[model samples]
Structures are given as structure tokens and as C-alpha cells.
Target: MTSPQSRKVSEPDAVKLPREIKVLVAAAFLIAIGFGIVAPVLPQFAQSFDVSVAAAAVVVSAFAFTRLVFAPLSGWLVERMGERRTYILGILIVGASSAACAFAGNYWQLLLFRGLGGIGSTMFTVAAMGLLIRMAPPKARGRVSSLYSGSFLLGNIAGPAVGGLLAGLGMQLPFLVYAAALLLVAILVATFLPAAIPVPVHERGQAALKKNILPLREALGLPAYRAVLTSGFANGWSAFGIRMALVPLFATAALGAGPEVAGISLAVFAIGTGVALTFSGKLADTWGRKPMILSGLAVNGVAMGVLGFTGNEFWFFLVSAIAGLGSGLMGPAQQATVADVIGNDRSGGKVLATFQMSSDLGAIIGPIAAGFLVDEFSYGVAFLMATAVAAVSFLFWLPAKDPHP
Candidate 1:
């Protein structure tokens, strides 16, 4: 029996998202769906050129390699061109690259085209991060990050199924479909996303816009930022690197399962992640980013540590889902922490790019290191190493200041 004013103060904002956020989320969904469409077919398409397995693998790696290499330049573009223009340009570049990939006359042509698309990928990715930071309310950054990430996750889940069906028609069809989807996203953003709102000059007469741009070195000096970088790397290592590369092989080798079972386990992991995403954002907003991030790292770490020891399918899937839950629980919080550090008024494309690089670097290195461990020692050792990496990240956060308070 609270009064209306008091009741209002206690309640959360309406569930509705801002129009700008909605547009971006929709754009994210389409972009994810398009990427998903291309993924299932890319390796197979390369193989169709009568290349060896290693060569086909190279085609897959080329995209990631280019992304890593071009990330800094993408950050520069975000600063120079403004988020809206950079985003639209990036979409068009990727769309054009996709179209080019569809019509590649040889293996090298496909490889080159795919690599070009990676440049565009980083461009849009950095711009999107900047836009989200600028537009999301300080209190609601966690929710916004979750929504943005969830759209991508859902699209990724749906994309492969559609890609698989499209493959029956032709390997190149998926690329064309993906290209068309990117075009749609570009048009949508161009039509709906407004230009940047101008900032007022500071009290001392310094240009507010210049003050808003956060330099990379300055960001690196913040303990919270440093802690976030570690978590980003660990998350990339375990979630993107190990999960994608090793899980399927582990299922087949250890559990004597088929490809179908591996697929099911992976899907279940995503299901776990989706369930966590439903509530993690709200928790991050209310409870603070630090607790959620640490908890997530611990849960994910333990789940991974035990993953290699599962004796059968039931245990395997259970741990996989648990690991996914851990990852999901932290995803929003990790993002919100970065947002907190950058604040809503400041431009942080460089900071965001560096953060992304940590993850990307981990993704590149984790599988290679884990694979070596598997070859020399065992799967147990490999997974344990992943656990160790996560632990190190947790420790890094221990002494760092929490941005929430």
C-alpha cells in the first residue's frame, strides 16, 4: 500500500526499448542471421573447389585473421566518419564482399573476397559498440547489452538451419542470401538510425566532442578496464575458442557419439545460454557488474574443468549447458562494465576495439594451445588449461575496482 509517487520510484522503467536501440537490435538480428546463413556453406564451398582439408580450413581462418588485423583501422574509421556513416559503409562493404564471394572463380578469389569482408565486419562492429555506449541509459546499459547480444545469439541459432536447407540448392546460394540480408540491414539503418546528437561545450570552453573521445592508453590505465580485458580474453578462449573447436571432437572421441549427438549437445549449450540471458541483464543492473562477472567466470571455469572428464552423453550435455549458463550470466555484465568505464557521453571506439581484440586474440590462440595440450597430454589437461586461464582472469578482477558503485 505505497503511495503512487513512492510506488513509481520503486518500479523499473517500462519494458519498451528506445527507437534507436530497437533499430540497432533489429539490424543485429539480420546481420547475425546473414552470418549464420554463410557459415554452414563457407567451408563446404571452399572444398568444392577441389582443395585439401587444410586449404578449406585456411579459408575459414582468413576471415578471422583479417578481422584481427584490421580492427585498429576500423576504430579509426569510427572516430573519423561518425558511427552512422561507418556502420552503413561497413554493411555495404560486407554485402559487396559477400556478393563477390558468391561469384569467385577460384579458391584464391574466394579467400580474398572473404578476407575483405572481415575488414567490413570490424568496421561495423566498432561503430555498433560506440553507438550503443552513447545511446544506452547509464542504468539500463546492462539490459541494452543483453538485448543486443541476445539478438545475435538467436540469429546465430536460426541461421545454420536455414543455411543447411539452402545448401541443398547450391553452396553459393547461402552467400547470395547473406548478401541480400546485409543489404536489407544497411537500408534499414540508413532509413531509421539518426545522425549523432551534438554535445554542448564544456564549462572551461573545451569542445565537448573532443573530450568525449577516450584514448586507448587512458582506458588501459583503469583497473576496471584492465580486469575487463582479462575477462574478455578468458571468455573468448573458453566460449568461442574451446567450445566451438573441441566440444564436437570430445563428444565423438570420448562419448563414442555421432555428429548428430555433437550437434544436439551444442544446441543444448545455446539453450542454457538463452535461459541465463533472460535474467542475467536484470541482475547485472540491480546487483552490479562485478559480482555477476566473477560468478559467471567461476561457474564457467568449473564447468569447463569437468567437461573433459564426463563419462557419458548425459553428463556431457549437462556440463555443456551449465557452461553456457555461466557464459550467458556474465556476458551482459562484462559489457556493462566496459560501458560504465566509458560512460554514456564519451566516445570509446578505441577502447571498445582494444577490448574486442582481447577476445579475438584469445579465440585465435586458445584452440591452438588447447590442441597442443590434447596432442601431448590429454583432453583433461587441455580443458584444465582453459580453467586455469579463466582463473587467472578472475584473479585479475579481484584487486580491480568495481564500476557499479
Candidate 2:
């Protein structure tokens, strides 16, 4: 086992970080902002192609699908080439893909570029996260993770407003602007991010690969790691897919709100989530992981159920805010839980990659499954189904013990 004391001191102990970590964190923030800029415009852009609402949703699905396919490969690439090179490569891919998306002439072209962007996104996110984990001390991991998440949250909050403004200029303007931002991020990473020194390979190459890949058997062999996976899936399912699917449907069908109102409501929800995440790191460290995780799921579950039954716009926004609160609170806790379980093992990269894969898979499946229920039955049924999934995650928390350093 790797001892924390033996790990190299890559970052200073002061509140002000070393320049390299700051650059890495800024790169992450910019990448997240670039993604957020495109997110809200995607469905609208797809609709312009004369597709149905369900089909238009495929735009979002395409991105998730690419991430699902490419995230595991990201681990292998990061390990083989080192995090700095992989991270820079991913950012450039995203930038080029975003520019291509601006020039797409048809739905197929748009889908292809969006999927390509997803590939870049997966590599950049996984590599940056791994780099942060590797560089921070075990005792400071929670704080560093929180700072990383907080940067993304700020980007997420700012991106939409910027996206909305640019989108108003033209549907393609957001993509163009996003591409430029991503290009800038790539430059930042290439110029300032520290080169990641490769881990020593074992004499048996197969043994090295096996050690880097967190197999299901080995991952489950650690109960806390399993719980972290479960928590991540639940977070993605409720916090991302279900909320995005149900909120607008409920707004249109139940509350009779216009597209603008629905859009504003969604933005408000995201802002709430960003605000909650601002303090989630400190909360998780002080309060312990289990309570925060359980509380977030429970709050989100009840909010989903309430949104399913209510027809009032006021209630819709209220429930949306509650769901955002739950998600914001849970995000850092889940990351912290993974850090706690994985410790200073070189496998932190692989462990985070696996945990990210579960969330991406949930994100891919959640909307499609919820959409089926909505079409076959009602929006209420879809919301209820999400509620049940969140409820099930609570059980994973019950028997799981916290992994303290």
C-alpha cells in the first residue's frame, strides 16, 4: 500500500496554491464553461432541423453516448501518455469539434460533431480529475476536490447566461464562442500545466494494465468504493437526466408555462445547485460523508415526487430548486468519498475513471428510460420512477461505512 507520507509534495500548504495547480483548475473551469455554453442551445438547434421533441433530445443523447464509449479508454490513454499531454489533446479536440458544430449543415453533421466533442470532454475531465487527486495531499484532498468542483459549478452557472446571450445573437454563435474559449483553455494547459511523470511499470506488462483497471470484482471487494459508485449513479440520474427531462415537461403540460419561463426556471435550478456546491466541501469534511449523501438523495426524491403531482408554476420552480440543492450538496461528497476510499494509490486515476463511468452511464440511460415512461404512461409516472431510483440509492448508504484517512 502507498503511504501518504511517501507521496511527493507537489502543492504548497498555504491557501494560495502553486501556479501549476491553479492552471490545472483553471483549465477544468474553462472546459466546463465551454460545455455549458452549448448545452442549453442543443435542443433548440436540433428542433430547427424539423425533428420531433424526442428526436431532438437525441442531440443531448449523442454527447452522453460518446462519453460512455470513450471514458474507459481515457484511463488507458492517461496512464500510457501521462495526464498533461492527454489533457491538452482532449481540450484541442473539443475546440475543433465545437467549431465544426457551428458549421454543421444538417442533423447528422451536428450529431457527429457533438459526439466528437464528447470524446474530448471525457478525456479532459478524467485526466484533470486524476491530476488533481494525484497532486493533492490525502488530508487536503477534500479541499482540493471541493475547489475543483466549485470552479466547475461557477462555470456552469456563468456559461448558460453567456450561452443564452450568444444564442440570441445566432443559434451558431454560442458554438463559435465556445470553441474559442476551449482553444484558450488548451493553450493554458499546454503552456502552464506540469508534465505528469509516468508511474513505474511492472516487469509484467499485463500486471500493470490489470492494476490500472479497477475491475468490478476488485472495486466491489471494497464496500466503500461500491457505495461511491452507487451514489454517483444516483446523483447523475436524479440531478441531471430526470430533472432535465421532467422539469420542462411539467412546466409545459402542467403549469402551462412558455418556453422562456421554462428555460429561466431551469437556469434558476442550476444556479441553486452551484450555490449549494460552494460550501459542500467543508460540509462533507466536518459532518462526515454518510449523512450528507443520504440527506441529498432523500431531499431530491421527495422533490421529484412533489414535482410529479403539482401543476403550479410556483411549485415547479420550488421543486426544481430543491432538487438542485440536493445535487449541489451531493456532488463534492461523492468525490470526497471516492478520494477517501482510493487514498494515495496510483490507482486513484482508474478509480475516479470507474466512478465517472457509472455516472455517465446513468446519464445516458436515465433520460431514455424516463422518456419511455413519459410517452407510454405520463410525466408523473416518469418522475415517480426517478423517485424510486433515488430511494434505492439510500439503501447503498445504509450498510456502507465511511473510509476515513
**TM-score of candidate 2 versus the correct structure, residues matched by position:** 0.86
lDDT of 2 by residue, 345-378 (tens): 4555566678888898777678888889878998
Candidate 1, superposed: residue stretches over 4 Å from native: 1-16, 198-211
lDDT of 1 by residue, 143-184 (tens): 888899999999999999999999999888999999999999
Each candidate's root-mean-square deviation in Å?
Answer: 2.6, 5.4
Q: Give the TM-score of candidate 1.
A: 0.95
In model 2, what is the error at residue 293, expressed in angstroms? 1.2
Which residue pairs show collisions in model 2? none
